[model samples]
Target chain A: MGGDNAPSVVLEGVAAALEADPALKIVLCGPDEVVTPFAANHERCEAHVTTQVIDMGEHPARAVRQKKDSSIVVGCRLVKEGQAAGFFSAGSTGACLAAATLVVGRVKGVQRPALAMPLPAPSHPLLLCDVGANADCKPAYLVQFARMAGIYAERILGIPNPRIGLLNIGEEEEKGNDLAIKTHALMAKQVPGFAGNAEGRDILTGDFDVVVCDGFTGNVTLKTIEGTSKVLFKMVKEAMMSSAKAKIGALALKSELYELKDRMSADTYGGAPLLGCKGAVVVGHGSSNAKAVKNGILVTARAARENVSEIIAQTLAGSDASNSEQVE
Target chain B: MGGDNAPSVVLEGVAAALEADPALKIVLCGPDEVVTPFAANHERCEAHVTTQVIDMGEHPARAVRQKKDSSIVVGCRLVKEGQAAGFFSAGSTGACLAAATLVVGRVKGVQRPALAMPLPAPSHPLLLCDVGANADCKPAYLVQFARMAGIYAERILGIPNPRIGLLNIGEEEEKGNDLAIKTHALMAKQVPGFAGNAEGRDILTGDFDVVVCDGFTGNVTLKTIEGTSKVLFKMVKEAMMSSAKAKIGALALKSELYELKDRMSADTYGGAPLLGCKGAVVVGHGSSNAKAVKNGILVTARAARENVSEIIAQTLAGSDASNSEQVE
Candidate 1:
């Protein structure tokens, strides 16, 4: 409901999901008037789907309180009551965050759930933590973020004991500010499965499984990488199109270029999961059209099947295991 | 002489510099015995081209001290006595920074000199400050960095007023961490000449005249941008060479691709300058070749001819327009 096309795009995503998966079920959350026409067209919409409409212009948090019928509020309630396996939202991130925390709640001992945004690599994507969820973070919080991200990688991305790297300046462990310095020490000692220090260039090298930083640096780093990729891609395209000779070369390379774009382009990565939340909520670019929204829904659905929350719980136990081992 | 190629590449750069500009004079420092042969044949090479070459295998800081005749130490000495205008090295960054500070001294009132690296931009190259100089930065240090970078832009890059932006997660004046938030307030009120807040995405927009951040974030941002450009270049080249059908198109587009490479290449700008020092010192890539070394020489020469140090002094003058206004 928060996307570029909002209800229409979301409805299309729902239709595409059901058609492709056959056994898929969705709880369409939006204004009844807004969603009825789209839902009416699908044959099994009424049987497999449940519609709890919310107002279009309503402030998501406040509306969640007053309107018991509001989609987002109802969706959270469904998860709380175990009527739904997991809640997914294309609604307001602020609204989603607030509702998820107040309604669904954080995992046991998890300081705060982080927004882990996956950066697409040539093969497997690199996951960065605290992207939008936690703005100001402590060293302790960053340590927890690494645990959560590491578990997510193991369960979702299928890597074992994923090497967690603290995003820092220099290769030297002593480099960076008080936060980075302390965080590095904490991850090295506390986070049992963590890799040592990782320089910024190490992200693309895929040396570390999960890269952790405070949201302030993490968000900036993520956006910087994103903005840089876009600018670089545009500049490269401009270069390829600069002269008659380059244009001919570009045409010859069109097929291979398309595959490369498909491989590296951020759009193909589906959506970024707000990981520490109780339910799997993947935030697609709010400007998502039909295809992007479709992919985002699928990502959340697959995450639910993977039991991401339980895997994170199990990894935290590994830290406890090493702690007890040292005590002996 | 501190580069990956050491004395050989450093020697080639000196030779190239001599060949290009007759007005360009060189004082080759390193093992004088090694450089003697090149100086004999090279036209610009003469008795005036003094050599105080330091030991190559020694530790950077210790090496600077034990042999006062070391290239880094001797070259810096030339700048100290006003025999030469600036120093250029593709050697150890640590050695260069140490030699410049201990030998060349810093501009009056300058706390820490920042290395402002120029990045390839569509319109003009960007100057990202504190790339490796001051890793853990304070608000005051960042403020000073903005001033130093401003001076470089105004004098060397010919950017007047030089709109400054503090790199952050978002463009909000209150968006960043403790350091960034404080710096933003100070920048808005203290440095009124600035362009206000800029996000990571804004770095390559060619919108602002200068961008400033702590070394941690700044270095990370720079490396990420560089990595993205490199990966894209490889991807494009691979696509262009993938197939015969595409090869025909590739053949037609050869000129445009060449122009693209020219526009995106980093060497065209030569080396990064360590700003706020009393004398000129350029730090090129450690892996730099002869042409890169020659360009570094020309860059320092231009800075010398343009009276960069004097302009910086004027730029920092509290009695002058900028600081007087800041004082008010």
Candidate 2:
């Protein structure tokens, strides 16, 4: 009810997720007409009819507060009330983030919750935190983001002692804006696996496990990569069509090219996790297909099973204590 | 004297530029051994011997102030003294920027000088302003950057009424950090050919002729595009070599692929102009080859011929008058 292709794609994705995992139970929250039939057809499924839907264009915080019976809000409420272990939405990113923060709440000691997306590097996946959460951030906020992202990398991605890099314009500590300079100084002393500063080129080079920045820079960097890939692929296709020999070559390599595209696509990772939240909140892309929705649910399930939120809470609390001790 | 392959590559590039444009004159500035022989051989070339050389890793402003005899410093001095109309360097970016700003000076009404880079979009090249100059900028400075960039696009790129966009995380005027929000308001009221806010994805979409941002975001965006292209092309190459059929296909499309690469390469654009400076100052890439250096000189010559600095000064003076009137 929140995404571009809501109801149909969402229902199809739920069905696929159910088929993939026999023990997984889903509680659909949408209009009765949208959820009732789907829930009745599937085993271990229940319908929690929602009266309202949050549109993609609506202001996130206002919509979450005004639309009490909205699917995004109700889904987050379900997580807070212990009815659901996790919430996955392929709807409005802002609405999902707002609902998760307001209803599901944040872990204690967390100043700001961050959105962490796994970038599909050629060698391995790299997690970029605060993709579009807190745009204007303090150095302390970035340090916390690094800590939470490191926890997520270890618990879910199975990366032991993950190296965390500070996303900056240059590799040197003295080479960025005010925020980056301050954050680099703090992260050096506070973070466990601090790998110094990573330039924009290092994001997808598989040099660091997690990269942290203010939401603005991270968001711009993420979209730039997406835009560049689309433009280059279009150029590649046009080049292939320019000649008969090239067209034949394109035909022979069609399947492999598609496989490469899938590997680089956002659909492969399915969704980005909202780290520092009390519940597992995975926000899927608004233009998500059925397969993407399915993968997003699986990621949510894994986070819930691993109790990632608890680990983040404990780790942050311990770090805060140590920081205060160092001050004393 | 300057750049990674100094003396040899720089001399070769000078020769190529002179050959291409018979009316052009070049003044070689470096050590006697490096510049004398080259200048002696060329018809319109003169040698200006400088003793010291600024290393790439040296602090920008500090090094520029200290290294009076260095190639970058001496070149900018030539521009200041009217011995040369422009300066082109494939040396340290920071050193070049510092020298140009400090020696050649700034336009009368300009608040801060900006580095404007031409991004090679598929449709036409788009100019991105403040690529890596002022990291933290005021709204007024951004307005000036937009004005300067728009002029550069119209004069050099030969576009009429070149559209300008304010780079932000989102398209909405309200959807950004403190700097973006304030800049968007100022640009809408002041900037000529303002096309509203452009998201990160809009940078390459050819929707806008010129995009303005603070240097930090602009730098991150620029490098992210470069990084993404490299990683994706490597993936494409790997995909091509995965099978015999694909290998044959790659062979058929080799020339077309290399052409596409050249079109997207930094060498094609040659150099980024340091706008708002008193003289035409072009900073070539550190890894620039002979061809890139030749193109850089051509770009510098074009900027000088167009009297870009004088135009920028007049435009800014008019804008400043209007702004003061509005205040009154």
Top lDDT hit:
2
Write candidate 2's Cα lDDT for B218-283 as tens digits.
998888888899999999999999999889889998999999999998887789999999989999
Report model 2's TM-score to 2 decimal places: 0.98
Model 1, CA-based lDDT: 0.74
Q: After superposition, how far is residue B222 of candidate 2 from its true place, in Å?
A: 0.6
Give the alpha-carbon lDDT of every model: 0.74, 0.91
Cand. 1: chain B TM-score: 0.88
- For model 2, residues A1-328, the per-residue Cα lDDT tens digits are 8568887998889899999999899989999998998899999889999999899888999999999999999999999999999999998999999999999999998989999998888988899998999889988889989999999999888889999999988888899988888889889999999999988888899999999999998998888888899999999999999999889888888989999999988887889999999889999999899989999998999999999999998888887765563310
lDDT of 1 by residue, B163-210 (tens): 888988666675677788888876776554688777878888888778
Candidate 1: tens digits of C-alpha lDDT, residues A1-328:
5566777787877788778777667766566676676667775454222355444445556766665655676777776777665676666655666677778777665778888877876547788887767777888788888988887787777778787888887667776777888888777878867887776677766787788988877877888777777787787677776766677667667778788877776666567777766767677776676776777777777788887876765666656644332210
Off by over 4 Å in 1: A43-83, A90-95, A317-328, B43-69, B319-328
Number of backbone clashes in candidate 1: 21
Give DockQ for candidates 1 onward, in order. Answer: 0.53, 0.80
